[model samples]
Target chain A: MSLISLALYIFEALAGAAALGILLVRNVFHAALLLIVCLISLAGVFVIYNAEFIAVTQILVYAGGVLVLIVFGIMLSSRIAGKPLVVTNQYVLPASLAGILSAGILIKLFSEQPFAQQPGALPGNPMNQTGIALMRDYVLPFEIAGILLLIALIGAAVTASSFYSKKQ
Target chain B: MEHTLILSSILFAAGLMTVIVKRNAIMVLIGIELMLNAANLNLVFFNRNNPALSGHFFALFVIVVAVCEAAVGLAIVLRVYKYYQTSIPDQLTELKD
Candidate 1:
């Protein structure tokens, strides 16, 4: 295997393990941390695939942004209160069965699809190409994405404000 | 690409397991995030060329949506916790009636 493939394997393993940790870990805080680990390793996986923009965005948006939101969620609610968040064991059998069934389906579908094992290297800097594409061909969607983000921000502020106003 | 797919699927399964098993509302949201991330990984791995219009753009958009989802979801969770004083799924069954 090449060095890049080796890196892919290691990072993928890290992400996979951290994903499992998120599932099984009892503490919500710890689970959130595990999720950060999983996300960061997946960013590494993105890097292995030569998706540097996505890798950086994964780290910035996921690890930096979303994780803080989750951790804040954890802290805001005193109900959970450092308690073990493990689920009831009754779900074990069904969860495992569903997991395996989906895995089988996923593997079957992917096997049918034709993905290139080794993609040709791009001629230009990916970031530059992405910027140009966003500005030219994908401009509408880019603007829509920005608008969606604005709507979400306003909606979140509105939704959360009810409690904030009541507290004052 | 195959290895990445396999790993992504495993991660998806783990996320599904968590969503199925966890009663905590926040934990379920975390599981949902995992599933979304797994999907994003698949998109990035299979992308051959055209980083801008390809999976990269979609992935970027998805990340934005994820941020929105997390913020709104957490806000709603906190609202529920404020009134109900519980974050467990089973106990918050007001809609069941």
Candidate 2:
């Protein structure tokens, strides 16, 4: 009913559709592109919730960082430029059934849960507050996340380099 | 809030289907990304409702973790593709004896 929820709905639709595109498209390149769309729309969804900081991070980390990494992996691992990457659909029956059952359970749980509290007013943006908290109270975890990311970078480099070493 | 939850549920389901049906290693990673995004959506949605800032903070951490996961996962995928000459997960059965 409200304009924000309307925007929310639109972004959600865009994201969901793009997610489906990631699955349905046979070309890994197209699927990677679809993933960028999905990730961007999800960033929009984060914006709709007034979490501007998270939204920007979503774009920065996901669209800018992760999706590019995926594309790089696709390019380096094989030549998918001309060929469409199709796969056999032998596992669809079980997975689809699992997907369906989980969806049903989630929908039923959502219907039954009573939402009594009115949604809060949208704050301007929590960027300042979140920054302060991250530096002050959450500084330890913040530092640890940096550590984790650094470790991941080194580990990934080592793993990928092992392949090249084997080749040489 | 409920609408957001339901939308995220659909996203998660789609991710599940992607993981299940797609045999391409990259596709499975994409599905995993979708699922992670769905959880992040819910966390942000609830943070909107309550303003505790916990959800917002955790969402950021989740993003960080996702970045790490993608890097490591892609490296592993690339390594496997190099050795196996294919990205199809079902076909890689050398160690399954």
Candidate 3:
């Protein structure tokens, strides 16, 4: 196998392992850390795909910013720091069966599709072009998304303060 | 050649299992993050060959949106935990009449 394919395989393995780790880990903090690893591995996959911008943003936003926020949320909400939450038998069978069916369908669909291997052409580095498109073609939605994030931030701050005050 | 798809499927399956088996609200959020990342991985893999740059661009947006979702979702979880003193989904039945 070529080096590129080898790297892809390695990154894919890391991503899969990290995802499983996140699921299996009982501690909330450990699960958050595993999620950071999973996001970083995903960033590596993006790099292998030649999406440098996305790779950097993935590391920056998801691994760094968002994961930290999640961990902080876990820490601040409750005093139960080390105990593992109990898993109930509410929807286990149905969810497991659905997961299995979805996995099978995805595998079958991907296997059947003839992935045309057109000599991997390095498409004219369109990172700059993408920025232009975001600013010009998709400007409205972009601005709207920004507004939504601002509203979410405000709402979170308000809710957090009220919740904390209520506890004391 | 076929490894990428196989790996993506595994990650997706793990995420599904997480959502199914874990009863903690935080665990559920982690599951959602895993599922979103699995989709992002597929987008990057497919964009490796396509020249249009659309898939890569969408992947970028998906990452951003995932971050925002985590932020908002975690904040809500924090509020719920304060109100109920627990993050377990089974214990959170205040509105379930």
Candidate 4:
């Protein structure tokens, strides 16, 4: 295998392992940390796929932003409960069986599908093209995404506020 | 490309197991995040050769939606914990008392 393919395999292994660890680990905080590992490894995979922008966004948004939010949730909830945030499995056997079976089916289906044999030529300036597409063709959806984010921000704030405490 | 697809399928399976096996709400949310990332990876992989940038744009939007989902979902979990004093979904059975 070439250096690039080797790197791709290595990153894929890391991401898959971290994802499995996230599921098997019981502690909420530890799971969050493992998720960071998984997400970073995925960023590497994106880099291999020639998606440098998506890779950077993955690191910035997922590892930096969302994981922090989850960690905060773990800390805050545990703090109030006065206990370390330990999680437990409920339906391990059934869940594992289902997961494995579904995965096998998906893999079989994916491999059977026809795909373009020759990989298309890479864009000369991917970043510039991406910016242009967002500004021109997909501008409407882009604006909608912004509005969706804004609404989610207000909704989260409203939902998380302690209305019961205020009433008391 | 096939390898990447297989890898994503594995990740999706792991996420599914996490969602079903874990009792904690936060962990469930993490599972959902994993699943979303798997789908995003597939989109990027498929769009690697396409010049329209549709796959990349879709992946970007997926990320945006994921952020909103995590934020709002975590907020709901926090509120549920405060009200019920537990983070396990199986415990929160009642809607209105």
Best by TM-score: 4
lDDT of 1 by residue, B1-97 (tens): 3778889898899899988888788889999999999989988877855544488888888888888898888888887876777888778879532
Candidate 2 lDDT at A36 equals 92
Per-model C-alpha RMSD: 2.6, 2.4, 2.8, 1.6
> Could you tell me which residue pairs clash in candidate 2?
none
- DockQ for the candidate 3 complex? 0.61
State the lDDT of candidate 2 residue by residue for A1-168, as single tens digits. Answer: 998778878888888789877767777888899999988988988887778899999999899999899999888865633355666555878988988888788878887987655456555446777888889989999999999999999999999887557675
Give a tens-digit lDDT track for model 3, residues A42-148.
78777777787789888888878888888787777545445444444347778778778888888888999877663264557657766777788778877877787
- Interface RMSD of the candidates, in order: 2.1, 2.0, 2.3, 1.5
Q: Taking the candidates in order, what DockQ does each have?
A: 0.64, 0.70, 0.61, 0.78
In order, the Cα lDDT scores of the candidates are: 0.83, 0.84, 0.76, 0.91
Greater DockQ among 1 and 4 belongs to 4
Model 4, B13-56: lDDT tens digits are 99999999999999999999999999999999998888887999
The estimated TM-scores of all candidates read 0.90, 0.91, 0.88, 0.95
Candidate 3 per-residue lDDT, tens place, B25-53, comes to 87888888888877887887788777666
Please list all clashing residue pairs in model 4, or write none if there are none.
none
Those runs of model 4 whose alpha carbons end farther than 4 Å from true positions after fitting are A114-121, A163-165
Candidate 1 Cα errors over 4 Å, as ranges: A79-90, A112-116, A162-168, B50-52, B95-97
Order by DockQ, highest first: 4, 2, 1, 3
The DockQ-based CAPRI class assigned to model 3 is medium
Kindly state the number of residue pairs that clash in model 3.
0
A27: Cα error in model 1, Å: 0.9
Clashing pairs in 1: none
Among incorrect, acceptable, medium and high, the docking class of model 2 is medium
